[model samples]
Every structure is written in C-alpha cells, then in structure tokens.
Target: MDSRSVSSRLRELVKFLGTVQGDLSNVTGPPSLLAPSSVVEVGHAWAQRPAVFAAPALESDPEKRSLLVLRWFLTSLRSQLYVNGAPGVSIKKPLNAFLGELFFASWTDEEHKATTQLVAEQVSHHPPITAMHIADREHGIRADGYARVEMTFNGAVNIRQVGHAMVHIDRYDEDHLVPLPDVKIRGFLGGCMYPEITGTYQIMSSAGFVTEIYFSGEGMISGKRNSFQARIYRREDTKRREPLYEATGIWSKGWTVKDVRTGDVLEVYDVEAPENAPMPIDIAPLDEQDEWESRRAWAGVLAGMASGDMRIVLAEKTKIEQAQRQLRAQEAAEGRKWEPLLFRSQEGEDHAVFHELTEGTGWRLFNERTKGVWKVDESKVVGAQSPYRGELTPLG
Candidate 1:
C-alpha cells in the first residue's frame, strides 16, 4: 500500500478503536483520566514498557523470538492496565472472580462471605480463576515456530477450536510467575481453528425421538490443553453445553449453564464420567500480602492455560475418531489392524501398556480420570489412549 493509503487507514482505524472503547463488555463505566491513570502508573512500574507486536518483528529472521517476548509483554500490559483501571477505587479488578464462593479474607459482602459454618460446601463451591489476564493468547492460535500468523474462530460450531496450553512463562510486572516445577494453564474458550464447524440452532422444540438440539462451532481456545470441540446440544428435552467436548480430551466439571430468559439447564445426551481424575497440582495460597489489598490478584492463569488445552484435546478427539474410522475403512479394504485411541502396543509379552487414546479416553486424561466406568462413565471410554504427548515445556 502507498503511504497516503496507509495514513488514511490508520486514521480510520484509530477512530474505530475510540468508538468501540466507548462500548465494550466488562468495561469500566466511562473514560476518565483518573481511570486510566492507575492502570498506566502500575503498568509503567513494570521492568519494561510493553511493545506492541508488529509483523516485521514476528516474521523477521533476527527478531522472531523477540517478537514473541514482546507479544507477551504487550498483551500482559493491556491486562495489567485494565485490571488496575477497573471501576472502583484502587484500580484493581474486583477480587470476586478469584474468590469464588469463599469469603474473602477481606470480603466486603456479608451474604457472599463463607463463614466457618460451611467449610466443605465452600470448598466445593469455589474453584480458583486459574488465569486472570484478559488478554489471553491461549484462546488464539499458537505462533507456531514463529510463523507469524493470526487465526480466528467463530465458535458457533466446533468447540475443538479451543486449544489447551501451558503459559510456561507468565510475567506481568513484579508479581512474576515462574512455576518452580513449571505450571500449565488449564481451561476452555469459545474459539476455533475451523469456522465451517460453527453452526447455530434455534430452540424450535424437542417433543419426540428427535428430541435433540445441536449447535456446533469451532473455536481456538487454550486452558487445560490447546484447542477444543464446542458443542451445545439439547438431549431429552434439555440443553447442556460441552464446549470443545467432541474431538478434544478435556471435560468441564460442575459448570452450570443457564438460559438467559428462564434459567433452565440443557439436558443434552449425558456426558459420562471418565477413568482417571486429574492429578492435583500444589498451589500456594494468599497470605499477608493478600490482606493488604495491594492489587489483590490471583495467578490462576497457569491453571486455566493447562486445563484449556486438556479440553481442546478432548474436543479434537472427535476428529481423531473420524479420521480413525476413515483409516479403518481403508485398512479393511487392505486387511490391516485398526489403531484404537487408547490401545496398547507391546514389544514383548510382559511389557504391554495402553497406546492411543480415543476422544473419550483423552477426556479421561484431561479430566484426570474423573469419568469412565461404573464409577467411571462408559462414554469416556468410547476411545482413548495413553495421555502422554511430548509437549514442549518452559524452563525454570
């Protein structure tokens, strides 16, 4: 593009950004100098000012990794700034999301507080945020090998569009996050790798054998694992959501989805339990620094990133199954053995272990063996393999 065209576009883009800023979701009421000041001040305190990523740096031979580093910096900068610029005094985003159902150490809500009266209930009710930064890269496509790419998902169809990942490194100011043993973010997003899978359905009715409502879409998400299969289905005259549940291996537990008009849970085909329960990761809790209210933030980013990927894999497992079926058809024509997702390969008679993982099996591993047979849901065993994929991890 010519310089004149470029300048014209920049002018237009800037105006568009300003217009959208006036109306965005979860946004602070209005723009005030003071509102942004708090966020900017804290943001500036960080060791380095975030550099907005540019394609030049990302695609450049000498600065590819640097571009990624800058990518993290810029995205983290926005979240930090936004949190610090949250609506009330002390520019921090409210602690409510992080607190869940537990009464905060300095909780302001009386009814919201968790008294010593109900410990077990509180524990079951609250699950940590896992990841907090709003500018999450996990939901987007990975900048694979510095290819310098940007991907989008409609999330109206395939939930496998969600991706699971571990933000091996997370640094947004002094509150540095360097997992001692390394941590992975685990969660899900309504993103996708393919948009063709995104499909929406209307609640016309479900009164007979055709009592099923399915809306499929694709999304690119990261939490637990990278990518997922997004599915919103109505089964037995009920609507239940399993975003990225088909092809991906991750499963969302105890999540409640309610209709906006009249809070009703969708009862799609019941998603069964899995074989293994997720292994617990050691988590450090808030202490003295927490009560100080000095930017009361919880680092659940890692957990969400880890689990999101797990969910993505589970969703993607559906695709894997379809591919396997195709492979089987060919094999049958040629007379060969079909490779099941969670089958075993043995080098010798005494050494036999599980091999591939079906989509359901992947869900078992992602959820860490929570659903499967009697105690486990049979659906989870539909297909599965071992849960070990040589993923690249971060260094200490």
Candidate 2:
C-alpha cells in the first residue's frame, strides 16, 4: 500500500478508536477495542520470538545466560513498537480475548535440536489479563508471567502495561525478574499513529546480578528514536560505582554488549541480518487444536478477514463474542466461576515466591486489577499432547 492509502487507513482506525474511547468513558477498567484481527493474533505480536529465547538456552553460565536472557527481554520490546500486517497499515486494535481463551505454539532451534514451547491463556476477561508460560525443557529454562494493558486518552493514547515475568534456570536454581514498559501512541493530530516506548525497566537475578535498562525517544536536540542503554552490576556492590557490563543501541535494530572493566566487546545483536533474524513459531493445525485454542476459536473470523469479506468477519466475531457473554451470564447466575485449565491463581502463601524476588525493588509484581497472581500448572503438561506439530518455520 502507498503512503496516502496508509494514512487514510490510519485516520479511519483513529476515528474508530475515538469511538471506543467514548464508549468506555463510564467503564472502570481497560478499554476494549476490537480490531480487524483477534486478540489471539496480537498476542503473538508481543510474544518473545523464537531466536531471542533460543539463544539463552545455548549458554550454560548462570550470569552469562542471565545476560543473554536480558538481551532477549530488551529485544522483545521491539515487537511492541511496530504493528504487524500488510505494508502501510500503521495501527491495528487487537480484539479483546474472552475468558479462558488459549494460544499455544512452539519454536524450534534447528542447529541445536531444541524446542521452546509457549502456552498463553486469557485468564481474566473483565480487566483482560493474559498469562503466558514458556519453557525450554531440554535446557531447563522456563519463564512464566502475566500482563494487562491499561489505556487512557488525553489527545493521544497512553498505554501502561502492568505486570512482570519471572525466568527460571532450574539447573542453576537462579531466577530473573523482568518488568514491562509503558507505551505512548503519538501522531494523533498528524493523522498517523506511531508507538513510542518510554520507561525504565529492570532485570534482576537471584544470582546477584541486576541490569537496569532505560528507554527514551528522539529529542529535539540530541537523542535518537528508540534509543536505549543498559548497565549491569552485581548485587553485593552497595556503592554501584562500577558496572560489570554496559550495553547500548537502538532497540528496534540491534545492540552491542561490552565488558566495563576489560573494555572488551562481547557480542552485537543485529536484527537486520538473515542469520540473526527471529525464527517463526510452529502451531497445531486448527482442526486438531482444542475448542478454546486461539486458532480454532477464531478460525471463522480470521478466514473471513483473510478473504476480504467484512460481513462474514463481523458476523462470525459477533457470534463468538455473544456466545461468550451468554456463557458468562449463565455462570454468574449459577454462582460459578470459570477456571483456567493450564494455570492456577497464586493466593496468600503462594505469593511468597513473588515477594521474595521483588523485595526492595519497589516493583509490584502483580496487577491489582487481575483476579490473582497466576502460575503455570506443570502437571497439566506432563502427559498432554503437544499443541505444536511442525518444524521451525521462518516468520515473515
């Protein structure tokens, strides 16, 4: 699509967003704006790509592996900055996920013969919180967490992503806690919508290493767009006068890592190269997936959208949504609550693990709007059929 056409589509999307904002005026929670695609599709957009997560599995050192995991966490931010779709399509709203909706996929590392599995579930619907668990069992690496987006409009849209993720290296008995960043949508008046992430997030490890990453946008005088710099230090160093490592780069493109004391360059991650590009996730066939699986649940709607039939898309989407609402109402009338199949809520004593890691960090690990902190049920996966069926496929 040409620039003019893109701008026109963006204008239309903005107008629709404005309508959604108006409708949500009396609502107390996050705004739900239905896009041309389902929330399941957009969830994949923010997921950690196969390449980034797979790289950490190749390393064995706790500290060095932790650093690579941090790199993957930073690189994952790039996914949130740009929308995925045909060329020139700037902003696309993501459909709200119904309660209990699930999205499952896997990423394979061909060279190492390793596979990383991802299981994401929409655990709550009112405030729309998503819980995701990723594991590379072969490498004894696992990450589990949940997040919810809270948006506000004041001329432009300001979105705050509230939640945290915990990465565990079972072999080393080490854990890394990472936080999400806030996003700002600009160019409302200019008729083009673009996202800028601005915030400072941290990656803290149980192995006594902490990395503080700062993100900033282009300034009128000196700074560049999507620029970020991170400093890694040991926990026991009270003075924090010296950093063990320093990383600098534009997040969307790449970053360079260097040792502070030795002044030796470690590694450079360039997303532009074919070899360094992210690998695609493999998913189960729609027919073979469970009824609640994202692809299976939204098959009709997605198929309609792909075929350019707006009537079919809207009708199918509305049917699914209406059915969900009816189910919720019936459950409410019967005084029963829906339970997630693959995850369980963490209550009082269960929060001990979260508190232990977040202590002194001044970070709220769980969003108050959510039902409760969530954790994956490992037993559910032990004998379960893998949701993904194929080899590593390159993502477009």
Per-candidate count of clashing residue pairs (backbone under 3 Å): 126, 0
| Per-residue lDDT of model 2, residues 1-396, tens digit only | 676865666666566556665323222221122344445444353344655565665677666776787777876665555654221234555666777777888877676566778788887777777888888777777788887767777666777766777888777777888777888777655555567777887788887777888889766697776788888888777375368888998887788999888999998888666776556768888778777777777778777767778678778777877787787777789998777768887763467666776678777755456667778998875645533323311110
* Model 2 lDDT at residue 89: 34
What's the distance in Å from true for residue 384, model 1?
Answer: 22
Error of 2 at 263 (Å): 1.5
Question: Which predicted model would earn the best TM-score?
Answer: 2
Measured on C-alpha atoms, candidate 1 has an lDDT of 0.22
- Provide the clash count, candidate 2: 0
What candidate 1 gets wrong by more than 4 Å, as runs, is 1-63, 81-89, 93-95, 98-127, 131-140, 143-396
**Which ten-residue region of model 2 has the weakest summed lDDT?**
387-396
Q: Which residues of candidate 2, in runs, are more than 4 Å off?
A: 20-37, 40-51, 54-60, 85-89, 220-222, 383-396
Cα displacement (angstroms), candidate 2, residue 373, comes to 1.1
